[model samples]
Target: MLTVQDHELVAAAIGEAETRTDGEISVVVAPESDSYADAVLHWALLVALLPLALFATFPDLLHWATAFVHEPWGDEAPPLRLIVLFLLFKTISAFLVAWAIFRLPRVRIAITPHETRTRRCRRRAIMVFQVGTERRTATRSGVLLYLSMAERHAEIVADELIQSKIGGEEWGEAMAALLAGIRAGQPGQGIADAVRLIGDVLATHFPYTGTDPNEMPDRLIQL
Candidate 1:
C-alpha cells in the first residue's frame, strides 16, 4: 500500500514554483488522494521473469540453443551470459504484457473540468466487441474521487486516488448534470437533476447505486 498525501506533491511543487518566482509566490493545490492497494499486476513481467528464474534455477536449457552457435566466429557468440538471457526475457515480456492489457476491453472513466479519459478493460460481447474491436471498452476501476482544497487554480487530479464507493456512471452522470448546473448558474436544476437521477436509478434496477436523497423511502431519508 503506497500511501501518498494529496498535499505532499502540492507542497513540493509549490516550493519549487515559489523559489523560481524569486520571492513572489502563488501556491497551488490539486485534489488530494487516498491510499489504495491494487492487484492488476504485470503478469507478463512475471511470465518473462519466470523463464529466467527457471534458467537460473536450471541452466542446462541454455545448452540446447547454444548448439546452433558453433560458427568459427565463436567470439561473436560470446559466453552465452546469464544476464543477457535475463534481460532478453525481460524485454520481450514487456511488449507481450502491453499487448494483453490492450486486448482486454474494459471501461474506466475519470472526469474533471478539464477533460475525461476512458479505457476498456474487459472482453465485450459480439455487439459490444464490434463497437470496440480496436480497443474502446469502458470498465470500472473501482475508483472514487474526493474533493480537496485548491491552491490557485481549480486543480483536479485523476490518478492515485480512490473515490467514494458509489456506482459511478449513474451517479457520475447525475453529478455532471449537477456541476454543469452550477456552472450555468442553475443550482436548482442541478439539485433537481441530482435528485431525479439518483432517485429514479435507485428506485429501479440500478442496484449498484444508493437511493436518491428525496426518494429514500421516507423512513430512510428521515433517519
Candidate 2:
C-alpha cells in the first residue's frame, strides 16, 4: 500500500534511526496476515448445509411444487434419489454463491474476528523474526516491526537480548503510535514514526557502541 516515495521515506527514517543505537530494526508490511479462506469456507459450508435441513424438514413443499410443475414423478413421495440430488445441487449452488461473495477481501476480513486477526498477525510477525531477523546480528539485538494492512494490526518482535532488557508492555505505546498513523491512512508515516520511537527505546537501553557494525538491512520490506 506504500508508494515509491513512501518506501524511500521509510528507508531513510530507518537509516537515521539506527545510527544512534546498537540494535537493529527491520520493518515488514504485508497486505494481509492470512487469506482467511478457511474461515470463509467454514462459513460457506454452514450456510450450504442449512438448506439441506430445511428441504428435508419440508419435503411436502418440494413434492407439491414438483407436482404443480407437472413433473413426471410417481403418485408417491419424492424419491430418496431425487431428494439427495436436489439437496446436493442446492448445497453446491450455495457453496458457489458463498465463495463468490466472500472472495472479496473486505468480506473475508469482516468474517474474521479481531482476536483471530491479532493472533495471526503476531504469529506471522514471529515467524518473520525467526526466519529473517532473529540472531542475525552479533549482539542479537534485532527487532522486527510487522504490520498487516488488511487486519490493521501491528506486532513488534524483539530478539532475546532486547526482550530481556525491555518488557513487552513497553512496546505498547509504539504499537499504538504506529496504529494511529495507520488508522489515519498514513501507514508509511506510521511505520517511520514507529521506527523512530523504537529506535529511541533501543537507544536508551543499548546506546551506540562506537564500533558497532550495521548488521541488518534498513529498507522497508513489503509483502
Candidate 3:
C-alpha cells in the first residue's frame, strides 16, 4: 500500500492520499520535482513568444532590406503605428497562448498500471483530469499525482492521482502482477516483454503520442 508518510505528497487536491477507487491504482511516473514549471515556461517562450516577436518586428524591420510589396499599415502616417500594432497583436497572441497552456489539464506521463483522479484541491469545482484507461470525471481541481514510498529516502512516483475503488482481493492480485515482473526468479516472460506491456497500459490512460485530441493511437508507436 502507498502510504502518505512513505511518499512525499508534493501536491494533492484534498487530504493527502484521500482518494481511491476500484481498478484504479495511482502510479507515479514523475512528480513536480522532475517537471518544474520553469521548463514549461521556458518552452512557451521558445516556441510561442520568440516567433511572435519576429512576426511583430518583421513589418517595420524590413527597412534594411526591402522585400515586401504592400505594407499592411501603409506608410502614409508613420512607422510608429505599424510597430505599435505589431506589438499589440503579438502581445495578444502570447497572452492567449499562456492562458491556454495554464488552463489546460495535466495528466500522468509515464508507466505503472494504474489510474489517477485529481481535482484542484481548493477549487474543487475547477479544472480536473481522470488519468485512466477510459475517460471519466475525476476530482475537478488541478492535480499532479505520484506513488509515494519510503525505503531509506522518500521515493515519489509520478501517478499518485489514481482513484481506485478496489476490492481487497483484486488490489492484492494487481499488486502481485506488478511485482511478479520485478522478482528475480526466472524474471517472468522476460524483462523486455514485461516492460513493453507496462508501457502499453500507460499509453491507454494518458497518451504521450501527441496532445491533439484528433490523434488516434499511433500505428508505429515508437515509445
Candidate 4:
C-alpha cells in the first residue's frame, strides 16, 4: 500500500541503482502471499472434534443427554439414532462457529505460525522471480526483492549468475534495512534502502559496462 509519491521515490531508487551495475533489479510488493484457508479449515476441524472427544472421555455425559431427550412419562433413554443425530448437530455447530471466527484476517494471521508465513512468502517470491526476473538479463544477473505486508516478510531472489557469486548471508544488511523500515511502518522507504544496498553488492561483482542494455523495467510492481 504505497502512495503516489512513494511510488515515485521507489522508481527513482531503482533507476539510480541501475546506473552503477549491469544487474537487473525488480521490486514487488503484495498484500499477502497466501490466503491460508487450509489453516482455518484445520482449526475448525479440531474444534469440531471437541464434542466427540468429551463424549468419549465421559460416557456418563452422553447417557445424561440421552435421558434428557426421553419423554417424561417413559423412563426409557433416547434411541441410538437420536443420540447420534444430537452429537452430529453439536459437532457441526462447533465447527461452523469456529470457522466464522478464525476466518477473520486479523485473527487468522495471529493464529498462523510465523514459520509457515515465512515459508509461504519465500515460495511466492521464488515463483515470481522465475516468472518475471530469472535469466532475463544478458549476464543473468537479475534479482527480485519481494515484500509481503501481511506476513511482514521480505525475500531476495536472484538469478543463476548472481546466486553463484553471492552467498545468502551476503544480503543480510539489505534484508535488515528493509525489515527495519517495515517495522517502523515505512515500507516504501525500507524497500528503497534495500534497493540501494543491493545495488552496491551487484556493482561490486558486475560493474556497469557501456554496452550493457536495460533489459528490465525500473518501476516498482504492486500486486
Clashing pairs in 2: none
Whole-model lDDT, model 3: 0.31
Candidate 4 lDDT tens digits, 150-172: 88889999998888899999899
Candidate 1: how many backbone clashes?
15
Q: Give candidate 3's total backbone clashes.
A: 25
RMSD of each: 19.0, 2.2, 17.4, 2.1
* lDDT for each residue of candidate 1 in 100-170, tens digit (9 for 90 to 100): 66334231011112121111111111222233121221221111111221111121111111123324455
| Residue ranges of candidate 4 with Cα displaced over 4 Å | 66-77
**Candidate 2 lDDT by residue in tens digits, 1-223:** 7999889988998898899899999999999989888889988988898877776799787666445543665645555566566668878999889988887999999998888888998899999999999999999999999988988888999999998999988887788889888889888888888899898999999999777899988999998
lDDT of each: 0.32, 0.87, 0.31, 0.90
lDDT for model 4, please: 0.90
Candidate 2 has an lDDT of 0.87
Query: TM-score for every candidate vs. truth?
Result: 0.27, 0.91, 0.27, 0.92
TM-score of 2: 0.91
Q: Which stretches of candidate 3 lie over 4 Å from their true place?
A: 1-36, 52-76, 107-223
Error of 2 at 96 (Å): 1.4
lDDT tens readout by residue for model 3, 1-223:
3234223322221122222211122233222222224435544455456645565578456442222322643567455555455556666677568645743334221211122122112121121123332233232111222222111011112223332321223233333443453353322222223233333343344334332232112111110
